[model samples]
Target: MNYRNLFYALALAITANLGVMAQGHKGPAWLSNAVFYQIYPSSYMDTDGNGIGDLPGITSKLDYIKSIGVNTIWLNPVFESGWFDGGYDIIDFYKIDPRFGTNTDMVNLINEAHKRGIKVCLDLVAGHTSDKCQWFKECASGDRNSRYADYFIWSDSISRKDMEQIRQRNSEPNPQASTRGKWVELDAPRGKYYQKNYYVCQPALNYGYANPNPANPWEQSVNAPGPQAVRRELRNIMAFWFDKGVDGFRVDMAASLVKGDPDKKAVMALWQEMRAWINKNYPECVLVSEWSDPKKSIPAGFNIDFEIHLADKIYNTLFFASDDPWGAKGKECYFDKRGLGSLDYFYKKYADIYTSTHDKGYVAFPTANHDFQRLRTGRRYDLQQLKVAMTFFLTMPGVPFIYYGDEIGMKYLPGLQPKEGSRKRSGTRTPMQWSAGETAGFSTCKPENLYFPVDTENGKISVAAEDNDPRSLLNFVRGLIKLRHSSPALNNDGKWQLVSDHSKPYPMVYTRFVDGETYATALNPSGHSVTASLAHLGKAEKMSLTGKVKYKTGNANDKIELGPVSAAVFKIR
Candidate 1:
């Protein structure tokens, strides 16, 4: 062959291989073993004594975060917002909220975090925007021809009379008319009603639905011009942050984008398109969803989907059980020590999700997020209970997210008035108790001026107090994270096999394998000693164990005895 022809052929072959690699990409390469720490920015710290946490405050604590053995940090919404629904009611996607500092401060935070080898992920609220947003303002200006008129869902007309009729129909006790509801009406110029996602201040963005009808003209189809325009705008918002060295986003209300999408096929398609664009342009940027359905979200291009605090069926079985004093009605969690919790629901669901998306994405399990009560809340207050809970959290198959203050056993305060749309959850969002000082070392602001009150109970939990205690929960978590980072068998991609039957009570056992090494993990969170047959460990050599618990290995085919509230990790040869 001629030299020129040979060079062209080689170039073609390389390009084809690159295309193949891109198509086969499962997820971000860095996420497989990453340990994430989630920070509620407004409550994490306060460096300038403004009574609130900001970017500079977070930047100043990079060392502390890195010391915890977390390599990735997920910051809740920092964008400019009206603070109606925390920071989720974003007014402008590009501007950082003045309460949290300027754009320059954000840049510094990303730079400082990167210096310590920590990746930063921002919270992206894609499903809605504040009613005060410029786009909404323009759309509500009484002109249907406005440039952003279709950016949000708007009814053509719903007069007071129409609303009264709707209310009358809703007031009727007939079960057939149960779905009837009311939409908020806008004043004069707008002359229409708009759909809201949560609070009245937050309006739902129009992403188009799977089906549209004459009765609901506002529900545009997915292929409509308005939906396409919104998609472009979403891309522009993503591109703006990606240029600033942000690693990725934890999308809020990710699965609820498409209105009236019962099966979620249309919303999934939207995410799939966005993921394709992200993979082609910014391949390293990860997309983590708030959606709990990993089977749908992973295939739709999310790198991870959290099973956060929601209903009883999913995560409640592990943490928020029926006996929880927090007033949530649900079955007992396996970690509750009540012996009423079952592993059947959790194991079956996890196994199904793992089988579907183990190679493509992960199902992140957090210690406790801002939306739920902390692990140390309610009746599960003992340090040993937390230790056993941490064992399961850190050893899970997916990436582990540690909510700020959870390591030190922070308690969820009760009976605090609502703030920024946090009702009962407001207690969980209290300022971090850094020390036992008068203000808990969070800030020097006056007691009344503080964003939220610190836990002032006689025996308040604090990082400083925990630091001095070698066997503290904070230290235990640090050790677990270090072990996870060092051992291939405990990382995200390790093979997970259930070693104990789910029907067993008290002790739960599982094994992780990687690179020809097997790591066996056992947890007994109850108050009584439990014995379990570990014939599976007969052929293997025992390695090491951590925690304050006691355990004894019996004969090859005999049962292994674990003391009350104990956990152990053993490497088998």
Candidate 2:
């Protein structure tokens, strides 16, 4: 064959190989061993003298994030929104929040992240928009002719009185912004009308669901809901940004999109349609549903659903609920007292089990999120306890998500609360304390100008001080993430079995096996030291605080002693 023909043949072979890699059989090449770090822009760092975390702040920290072996970045929404809403109540779908950075800054972030072979997934809040969003503003203006009227779910009166009946019967809060019931109160009559069924500021979208009909007017008419018109508008919003080159999206409140119908086919269809659109254009795009319910399938058309509940089950059970004085009460059984879960269970249930998602929240074990409390301030983060928690979350399966300054153990201060109250609720959301420095490096602005104050004691603790301290949690996280990346069994699908048969209080142990290879991991959750057997292994390479340890011909009687909150992984041969 001629040289050109030979070259073409080689190109075809390479394409085929890459296609196989993308099939996710051996797992997607991007994710097989990827570790993701979640950056909350508001608290990550302050550049430009603003206390709020910004793109430049993030850009400055890229090297630090990468140093720990993280290969992916899942940013919490940086989109334009009212400041206090945690970026989830987006005002504009396409614009980055000014407080965070400019669109150019985001593009720069994507560029830098890509240079290191890291994928970037931004959070998408599709369920509702800030009342300030243009769509909501137009719908509120009472202009029936407005193109955006149907973009959100709004009704002058009950289209489905039956649902209203149920709402009253169950004492359930109205799902709509104007509705009067459990949580929302209708705005007082303006002239003659008091609109019911709406959030004061977050108006819900109709999502094309009509009362009992289960079909909206736009979707019911022939030639309506076609890919070209209304749906096109929504698709355009997504495309506008994906074209800017994001790897994927983590769709917010995923289940709420389809909660109106009993069958849920409408919501499923919408997701599938969006997935198809993405496939046709952005083929590498990963769509993650924040639905949390694993039972909710993606119709074989969409790629992934967030495994939130799976992690919830594990995190709540393994350490948080079991260790805290709160024990497990009501929903507390599913979440820690601080509303996060234990580390061990999260690894077992979802780590490798989930094929695609912006690293399950469990792996990262973010103590503070926009919606929840920071662990440091939540009555959870004792210095030793913090060390132990970090040890478990960092080494377990999936990408370790770093929530801003969590590495340095920055925490929320007492008496400080977010839009929602509770120290645990707002702990991690406080400003980053750069040093014992003034205002903790959050903002040069007067403390009153800042959205949240720096925790006087634990707030925005700096990497500067922690970076040099080998014993600091930040250093510990760096070590664990590096260690996890080095392990093929822990990174991928290793057969995992719980070692629950042990006779110990609060210690956790489990073993993972693949082919003849096995990794047995044990955790001592209790305050006291304890010993456990490595009886499951025939032969194993064990890991301890000191160094690589090993065991051979293990039997039912084999065991290892563990320090309080300490963990070990033994590789079986």
Candidate 3:
């Protein structure tokens, strides 16, 4: 081959070897072993004594977060907001909310985190904004043809036919924003009814519909002047933060953009445009979307799409038996001590996404986020059960997000009165428990002034208490992370295999292998001992074990045993 052609071939080979996107976008190679910690800033740390957590508080905990083995911290929206739907109803993209901290504090936090080899990902509320946003206020008060007028969706009145037509054409399985379909009304001077993305306080920004029905004058095409401008605004917002040294974004309601199109083709195209722009400008910045479907989101150009654990999502099979409070019962989750759960649900979805997107992007998993219950909630709080769950998450493929305070087994405090619209989720978003005290070391302020009351059991599950105990859950998690960082076979793109087992949910066995290196893992969530066959290892000698393994065998008949609610990782020599 000619020199130029040979060079092109070599480049393609190198990209493939590095497990990069086939589309030529250089995804953040750091995400290969990235262990992310999701922080709901308002509840993470309170330094101001005003009971609200701030960017400075986050900066103060950089060492603690780093020591826990998190290389990336995902902070929920820090932008100025109306505070109706948590911090998601963003009013200003460029300025940090006064409740959080100043813009300088954010930059300082980013710099401090990077000094500890940690990347910071801020939540991007891409779809909508606070009704109190200046743009929305102007749009509401101005003429229909005003500059900010087309920034959001506005209509005089919606007939039944129009609502049905719009909903029928917009195709995303279970669309969140459109399901409500409740538009707010205003006086005669302003538009009669305005469209909303979520709560009443938030209005959906106009990205325009992918396919506009000619009969519906309200429906705007994606190429319309307003949409194109909104797209530019989105780009500008990203540029503002990227300039400030922010790492990337976990885009909220990513798939909810670009309405009125079946098959989500137009929304996908919109993100593709974004991907091209970001690739050209900030190639190293990662974009992890809350699309929850990696098969489409990865191909659509996001670096990683979270495989969220929701009722309908694939992750509920494991770690969440029910969504209710402590000891609630329903379908037994894969992490339950009863071992009544099935892996078929999680495995099928996981395998399909992994098979299609492994080389292109990744499917990220979260222990828990601000929206739902935690790993220590319900009847699953036992340290052994948690260790097994952590082992499965840390060693498994894709990025793993440890929601703030999940490392030390923070409880999902139930029945705390709702605030900032957390509702039943208020318990899950409680302050991080650091140590025993009146405020549980979360803040020096009075207990009544806390963002949400610290858990009553904080004395038992606090981080400081666990950090000093060698056998505690905190130490177990640290060990798992250290091993994950040290093992190539357990890295993001390692070839994975499921060891055969007849025990069903008793013992979950899988192996990670690459470049002649291999590591086998077994998780027994059951209440009794279970054995898994390691015959597939092919004369490979057992090297070392990470977690507690009750029994292991080495003869030609290879078998490893697991204790109740325990996990073991075996390094294959």
On lDDT, the candidate that comes out on top is 1
Candidate order (lDDT): 1, 3, 2
Give the TM-scores of the predictions, in the order they appear: 0.90, 0.77, 0.90
Tens digit of lDDT per residue, candidate 2, span 347-372? 44554444343222122344334544
lDDT of 3 by residue, 1-573 (tens): 257645654553444333334335428678787889999999888898988888998899889998898799999999998886789989998899999989999999999988889998999999999977988888888577877878888777688765664466355443433335556555435577777877767888899987688787768977778887888999999999999898899999999888886687778767877876777688778889988888778867788888876424777777667654522356667788777788887777777777888878877788888888888877787777788888888888878889998898888888888777677788888888888987788788998888888763748888877888988888888888898888778877787877755336567888899999988878887887777666746434433333447434566557767767777777766
What does candidate 1's lDDT look like per residue over 439-540, in tens digits? Answer: 788888887877888884543588888876878888889888888887888899888978777778657888888888778788888777777776646444
Please list the Cα RMSD from the true structure of every candidate, rounded to 1 decimal place: 6.6, 8.6, 6.3
Minimal lDDT window, size 10, model 2? 188-197
Better of 1 and 2 by TM-score: 1
Candidate 2 TM-score, true structure as reference: 0.77
Which residue pairs overlap in candidate 3's backbone? none
The list of candidate 3 runs beyond 4 A from truth reads 1-26, 161-179, 188-190, 310-312, 323-330, 456-458, 538-557
